[model samples]
Structures are given as structure tokens and as C-alpha cells.
Target: MTQTGTASKTVFGVPVPVALFFIAMMLPTAVSVNLGGLRLSAYRVVLLVMILPMLLDLVSGRRGRAHVFDFLVLAHCGWALLALINWGGVAQGIESGGIYIVEFAGAYLLGRLYIRSYEDFAAMARAYVGLVLTTLVFTVPEALTAIHILHDGISGAVGGPMAPYIEPRMGIERTFGPFDHPILYGVFSASSFSLAYFVIAKRQLMNFSGMAKVVGVVLATFMSASGGPYLVLMMQGFVCAWQRVLGDVQGRWAALFSLFALAYIAIDLFSTKSPFHVFVNNFTFSRESAYNRILIFEFGSAEVARYPLFGIGLGDWVRPVWMSDSMDNFWLVTAVRYGLPALFLLLALLIGLVWTVGQRKNLPPEWRRARHAWAFTLFGITVAAATVHLWNALFVLFLFLIGAGAWLLDAKPDPKKGRMTQASFKLPFRPAARLF
Candidate 1:
């Protein structure tokens, strides 16, 4: 899709975004990825997750300017077909493939919606940073009140309810930093600061106060005990800021993102910081959580064997209640459930996007920073997935950032041209199509 007048794109008759949204909404209900720690589900629901994102493209008329991001959807589509006939082991493969689709599409859709413009992308980054800051400040108290801290449900005793905060691990209770879980907190925080750091290093953030705000956000993410998410996101941020934002700047913004990352690690390592109470209190591996996805995939191999290709049918993974409680690594899970071919297809789709976004010529310095920020943000998401689900609200913020960055690149030259003036519709994306 090359960007033009709004026209409803669809296959048969369903709007892709809408359909996928429904499937995501239904996924948990139809089949819990965690079946009381058994980690087995009905495969049919998984299929819906796979096919849904594609519908987004089919319905977008394929000529829409934002088609570059749509490449991800294509990857999922390939996974779907591969799963369908997965080396003739179709059943288990389809279900697993379906599940991954839900996770991937959820993140992508948010990117399409919120990141529709440079301003929106920047706003999302700021907001995420703000969230991290808020959590950092709030966690101080949560950390202070020993008894009230661990003996709780939602979180925040002296303050208000933090709907998205979570502390899955025992010792260092990662305060959702902002969205859902510690890992998610890590993902969101990493993406948030990565963008902020890029902007600052490249001078795109502008002004001393804004730069300070960006730093504050990055610092907050550090304090929250997110583990792996914290480490990886920092590296991705560094690479992006250096290549995309800095261009040829000496030791300034070019390496700013990395510096922040290093500083964060240094503080965490040297400081007497600890989850403190959680460390003294309960500590269980919770092997059933995101940490044990590998186990789940191992068990799923047999299930896939039953349906080598084409899958058990076309649905979520249906474990007969007695299945083991283990989650698969995204790569293996895709193959065992959908087939090896589907996994390859999925990778191709993502790699293609990486190639397209990585190419840029003589963009203005500021625009260049913005571009690198989004590109790095996308790559970072890919890396972050290894540890946690990418769809959590925290990481989804990056999706918005990328969209905004793209919008900035393609923004209308004339203020009045191609822009909707009405507050009722002109926000972004489907303003023309949304009016219906």
C-alpha cells in the first residue's frame, strides 16, 4: 500500500484490524496459554491469531503508504501456511503458530495506530518515560513499607492502584515499571529510553529540560528489577542512536544511548539496591511463567508430530488436559506447532522489514534521528521477545513511536493539505476511513 485516499481493505468482507483485535481479545478466553501451569490449549484459537493480522493488510487496500510495517503481517502469513502443511505435521504446528501470531500482531497493531506521526511517536516515548519515572518514585515507598509491600494483590498501599504493575520474581520485584510485568516493564522501559536517548544524542530531543526528562525515564527503568529486558534493550538503544541519530558525531549523541545504558548497569551493580523484602520473603522459580517457555515447546513436539503438516486442523493448540506445563521458545514453538517452514517464513517477513527500514539517504539531521529511533525501536522489540511477550502495553508504546516517526517522514508539506482539521476525526491513521 502506497498511501492514498481511504478505502476499506478486506478479504471477503472483514476489516483486518478489527478481526485481529477480536481474535486477540478472544485468545485468552478460548485457550489460556497457561492452563493452570499445564501450558496446553485448544489449537483452533491460535489459528485466528495467525490469520487476523493479514486481514489488516487485505483490508487496507495494500496501496496504503504504511505498507512497510505490513511486511510483518506477511511474515505471520507465511508462518500460517507453513503451519497448515508443516512438513505434514499440521495439528500441533498450527496451534503453536496461531499463538505466536497473536503475540506479534498485538504489538504491530499498536504500532500502526499510535505511531502514525512523529509527534505521536515522541509523545508516546515521553509518556512511557514518565511512567518509568512515576514507578521509580512510587516504588521507593513500596520498597519502604516492608509488610504492606509483599503481602498485597494489585500494589501501592499508601498511594493509589497501579493496574499494570507486577512483581513476578521473588527477590527483586520488578514494579511493572509502567505496563504489565517486570519483563514487560523492561521491554517498555528499554524501548522508551532507547527512543528518548536517540533523540537526546542526536539533538532531536532539544532543550536542556527535555534532555533531563529523557534521562529521568531511562533511570527509572534501571531501578525496576526487570533482569534480561533491562540489559538487552540498552544495547539495542546504543546501536540505534549511534548509527541512525549520531551519523558521524564524535562522542556525543552518537554514543549517548550506550552511555546511558552503561550508567544504568553501573548504578544497579554498585548500589546496595535489591528487591530487599522480596529477597527476604518468598522465592519460587514459578517455572510456569515466561522463564520456562522452553519447557513448553519441548512438550509440544509430540503434539506437532501428530499433524506434521496442515496442522491438527486450523485452530489453537488443543492439549488433552494432561499436557505438560511448558512454553516453547518462539522459534521452536512456531516450528513444532506450525512446522519448520512457517518459522522460516515468519523470520523472512521480519528480516525484510529490517532491510527496508534500515535504508535511508540524505534525511535532515533531526529526521534522521527520528528514523533511527524507530528502526532501533523495532529491532529492539524483536530482541526483547526472547524473554517476554511483546504485546504488553509497555512495549506496545514503541509501536506507537515507530508509526509517529514514519508519519513525520511522510508528513504533509502544506499544513492544510492532506490533513483533517476536525478534532472529531483527523487524529491519524483511518481518519478518512474512521468517519464511517
Candidate 2:
């Protein structure tokens, strides 16, 4: 799939950029390799590989264009740096805040530069389907035998501490499946399920392969056995129905706001607790964990009121030695860590990305497939992340989703000339004819 006389050459079958993107996205986080006496996770190494070409492109005066969302993401990082600076000294900001920016913001930049068109995006989708299928092979064995082959095997090689395995819950041993936690594993698969289905629905994937991908993602989700992922999958169904039955996009938003209002009113009338506390208490599988989360949210809310503008820098805001490890909700973590301004910037990034993709009506039919795929992917992940702490690989993956949506939103289609416009590009492989 080479563009003649261009740098987009194929490597081992896939285009070079697409291959690097695929490796960076799909390489198992449970694995790592050492280079020059330094140990690094597989994803870090793959990201370095992806970044190398981008750096070369910059040197060659072929640096990719930036979008508005890039600045919004940067603002989120800038706020995070300020928070870290307030919490600790410059060293902490440089180490933690800088790394956060590189992991989250860098992922979006890499995605925007590499995945410039729908064809590149589809190649990534195909690679994602492959990842789902491959993960299933390990998960199925782990589900039945209670053996984490990938985790156990890679632990020795990585020479770093791995997340400890927990006992089975609700008669299911939550499968790690190459992710740090079962919840993340589930959210990752469930997100792929929605994204793959969106692509399939748009006829981007061959019938058989698309169906197989859907089946594979479903199996992986169930293997994760996390309530959060199940909720995310359910939300995808709700969103699909909301889009179909509930008028249009605006109508869906109205309905969502109405539901939130009703839930808030119900919480006020029925209990002496906040809606978030009431909602998570019933939604979570582990009552103990859920209670702690409620306490965290309660304590974090107080911290927000006290430091509404700038926020009380990190340290142990949540009391009790047991629960002080973290605040589970991604939104809460951002608010408590970086203050309300940072949280607002993050919200703007997510909402703006989704709105730009979902509201676009001028995209080509093929490009439209990617638009919907990314919209639902972000929506599902947003819902999932609300209840979970997104760190490491998952946070990077989320930023990649935002970057993809931003790229698609800025793209323009040239249906008349059949040329690559700022919005659309010609496919390297004929999607209609390809089976895999």
C-alpha cells in the first residue's frame, strides 16, 4: 500500500506509518524490553519508534499540521504542570507533569501526524480488531485455567513490579489480558467493540471479518468481568438507541441532561448523599470499594470548595490509610489533582472533540465511517473513565482517540475531483473488495 514516489512505503505488508501506529497502539503493556541498560515498557519503546519518524519529518520540513484541539490538550497539560509545581517543586513537575504531558498529549500529536486520513485510520482499526482477537486467545486460557500467561511471563522480563493478581469475584476471575487491571482490560475491549461495530456498520470492514471482530471484542469484555466495562457497553447500546429513536444529536443531549436532572432530584429526595455517591454505591460490584469511592468523592468535593480556583495540591486529600491511594473517578482525580480549571480544560477537550466529530455533515461516506467510529469510541470511553482511574497506557489511548477525532473533524472531502482534500483521501486498499 505504497503511494508512488512518496515516503508512505509499506513495511512487512502495512504502510510504514500505519505499521508504527499499529505497533504503538496494540503492543501488550504487560511486556517490556531493555535497551542500553534501561528497562522500558513495550508501548514506550513503540511510541519512541513512532516518534522517531515524526522527528525526521520535522527536520525534513514535512511536519504535520496542528489543529485547535492540539492547543486545548496542551492547555490541559499546562494546567497539570502548574498543579504539580504547586504540590511539589520543579523536580516533581518535570518528572510527573512532564511525563503526563508526554504520555497523554504526545499520543494525540502522534495520532494526528500519523493518522492523517481515513485510510490510515482504517488500518489502525483493522489492527485494533487484530488486537482484540489476539487478546482473546490469552484471555480465554486465563479465564479457564486462572493463569495469566502474558502477565506472569512478562514480569520476569520487565524486572519491575506488576499489578498483583486478585481473587475471582462474583464467580469470575477477572482476566488481566495484557492490561494493568481487569477494568481497563474490559474498557479497552468494550471500546474496541463499539468502534469495530461502527466501522462494520459503515461497511468499512469485510462482512466476515467485521463480524469476527465484534464477536472477539464481546468475548474479551466478558472475560474482563468488570462492572465498569459492562456499564460502558450498555451505554453504547443506549447511545445507539438514543441516536436512532430520540430524534437527533441535539435531542440526545437534551435527553441526557434530563436524565441527569431527574437522577439528581431523586438523590435529593430519597437520600442524604450526593448523586455521585448514590449512583456509584448501587452500580459497583464491590460494596466496600464503592463505599470508599463515595468517601473519596465526598472528601474531594470539600477540597474543591476550599481551593475552588487553584486547588490544594496533591498529597493525601482522601483520609484513611487504606483509601488514600487514589480517587477512583477520572474527573475527580483531575479536579483534585489539578484544580477546577484543569478539569474544565479536560472537559473542553473531550466535549469539543466529540461534538466536532458527531456534528460534521460534510464528510465523505467513507470518511463518515471513521467519524462515527471515533465518536462512539470516545463516548464509550468517557463513560467508562468516569468510574476508573486512567493512567499509563489507558490514558494515552484516550488521548489518541481525541487526536483521531480532531483530525477527522478538520478533514474536508473532494467528491468532485476524487482527490485528497484536507478532509478526505483515497484509500490505499479497496475496502469494498478486501476480506481482511
Candidate 3:
């Protein structure tokens, strides 16, 4: 939906600033340096490198008046740090909590500062597409052979593999690419589905290049062979299709919401399991996985009840000895790891941003389309997080996208040209900006 423009600043054709973040995420976690007992991975290093400039932008009010969402993010990070300190003591807390701050708040600030307009958002999407496509070179083969070429190469060079080898599922190898798990890779790829479709495809279903990007996204997600990523793709696909078919209908989303509420209520009344349990059972790859997640919610909530203010931090959660330590639900894990306040702040940030962006009015057609794409992507991800846990790079990326969409709230309509322009922010760095 972005208008044609000169190319933006790029490194080897990918957009800068955001390019730095995406490139760092694409690298293996094994690629890191242990500096003074703190391990700085590529993404962490990039976040640290860019933090000062981003803070300067925020302090200067170059981006815009700070919104409640901004404070919510900061508060979430603060509470998380406090919880860690409460559990681990000051020194260990700072060491661990500092990493979360850099990865979460730092990545969010990068998106908030750098992507300040539609063109900027488009450039970010293009950079993501390029990165996903590049990874396909290794992912596709890894999926087929179960021999992670990129990870193997990095492991050999770095002295060990960061991600453990996952056994094949349904006779096909689950490929994680550079991430620590197949679900993370799948989620990373699936997050781009709507962006590629609406921004790259430009709402034209028949457009070859756009469709190619969509197909590529699906292929990459499929390589992960994980139910969580598959769920993301399906949710985005359904939302995109609903938009396409009902774009002309007023209150369509409201009607859809009503229908969903009715279905949820009906399921809650009739089904022996709660709606969430039923949903998880139907959606996962196996009943065992679904049952485990149910138990996670049961025991995980009990733990939360015990430590309501500051969670157990990195300490082990109470569960059956037979149960694995892994907590698959991201939202639950946040509450379990930190506290309810931390989880509440995060949910508020995510839901608040999505609501504010979607409620913006009088946008030009292009900007409106872009808003839908961004909002829909986040919506799918918000739901997907309940089914899968996000950590490391994927977690940073999830927060980054929330920050990236904040610009939409500040878009003002230009009366003279009947176009949408960023409010209170001037383009600080623009170098010729092309999407393709």
C-alpha cells in the first residue's frame, strides 16, 4: 500500500537500522561473545549499539508524544527486572534482567524510532521478506534432510550447537534455521505472512511477485513443522481472506467478534473441557502436547497464585516430576516467570497498541490497508502466543513489531495532497526508499 519512493538507506539492498536488527536475529545464537560474564549475542549487541540513538529520539520528541503503550512496555520491563532482582538478588538480577531489558525495550525502541511512516514500515517488511527468503536457502534443505546446514556450520565453527537436534515429526524433519527451536523459526516466518500479502501483494490476489512472497512465507513456516507456526499461518490466512471478502461491509469485524464470543460461550457450556482446553486440544499436533499444556496452565496458575507479586523468577515451577520443565505458553510463562503485573502490563501494551492503531480514522486508502495488515499480523501473533512460547530472538521480534506499529497512531492526513503523513516526526534518515 506504500506509494512508490526512492530507496531507503540499506545494507546490500536491505533497509538499514531495522536491517541491523533482522540480520542479527537471523544469525545463530551460537554466534556470541562472552563479555565480563555477560553473553552478548548478535541481536543483543545490535540493540545495545542502537539504544542511545533511539533514546535520544524519544527524549527529543522526534517520534511523537509518548503514548500509554510506551509506558506500558517500560513498566513491563521494569516489573520483570524487579521480579528477577527479588528472586536472584541484585548482582545476578542485573546480569539476567539487563539482557531482557536490552532485548525487549531496546528492540521496541528501535522500531519506535526508526519506522515512523508508511514508507518506513514498508521498508521494514521488505527487509523481513528478504531475510526470510535468504534463510530458505538453508531451511528448505534442513527440513528435508534433518541436517540443519546453517546450525551445523555455525556449531562446527563456534564449537557447539546452540539449538538441540529435534527428532522428525510426521516423517519430516522440523527445521529451526538459526533459531533455538522449530517453533521460533516457524513463528518468525509466519509473522511476515500478512505483511507480505497486504504490503508486498498490495491487495492484488493475482500479483505474481506478491504471491511469491506469500508462498515463500508459507514454505518457510511449513519447514518448522510445528503446530504453533501452523496455527499462526492459518489465523492470518483466515483474517486476510475475511478482509478481502468483506472489505465493503461496515461493522464486519464487530460482527465477527460477536460470532466468536457466541461460539466461545457455547463451547464453554457444552464441552467438558474449558474453551481454551478444547481449542488447544483441537489445534495441537498431538493429544499429549495438548494435555501437557493443560497441566501447565493448571499447575502454572497455582504457582502464580503462590507468588502473586514477584514470581519464582528463574526457579523451577511446581509440577509432576514426570512433566518436562518446558512451559509452552508464552503468556503463561511471562506471568509464571515474573508476576501478574508484568503480564498485565504486557497484555495492556499489546492490546492497547492494536486498538489504537486500528481505531485511527481518515487515513488515505494506502495507509488504511497498511494499518489492517499490521493490526492483523499482531492479532494473529497475540493469539498464537497462547499456544507457543517465544524466547530469545522471536521474543525480541514480537516486541519490535508492537513498537513498529506505534507510528500508525501518529499518522495525520495531509489536506493539500490527501495523503497520510507522520505527525510530529520528520524523516531523520531517508536514502532514496524503494520497497522492491
Candidate 1 wrong stretches, greater than 4 Å: 1-107, 143-172, 177-180, 200-207, 244-246, 249-328, 389-436
Per-prediction TM-score: 0.55, 0.83, 0.91
lDDT (CA) per prediction: 0.46, 0.68, 0.82
Model 3 segments more than 4 A misplaced: 1-9, 12-15, 413-436
Task: Choose 1 or 3, whichever is better by TM-score.
Answer: 3
Query: Candidate 2 residues 134-218, lDDT tens each?
Result: 8888888888888876666566465645657787866767888767788878887887765677665454346787777777888
Q: Which numbered prediction scores highest in lDDT against the true structure?
A: 3
Prediction 2 global C-alpha lDDT: 0.68
Q: How do the residues 20-111 of candidate 3 rate in per-residue lDDT, one tens digit apiece?
A: 78878887778889899888889999999878777666666655556566667778888999999999999988888988888888988887
Error of 1 at 21 (Å): 11
Rank the candidate models, highest lDDT first: 3, 2, 1
lDDT accuracy of residue 78 in candidate 3 = 89
Give the lDDT of residue 183 in candidate 1.
53
Q: Clash pairs of candidate 3?
A: 6-432, 6-433, 7-432, 7-433, 7-434, 8-433
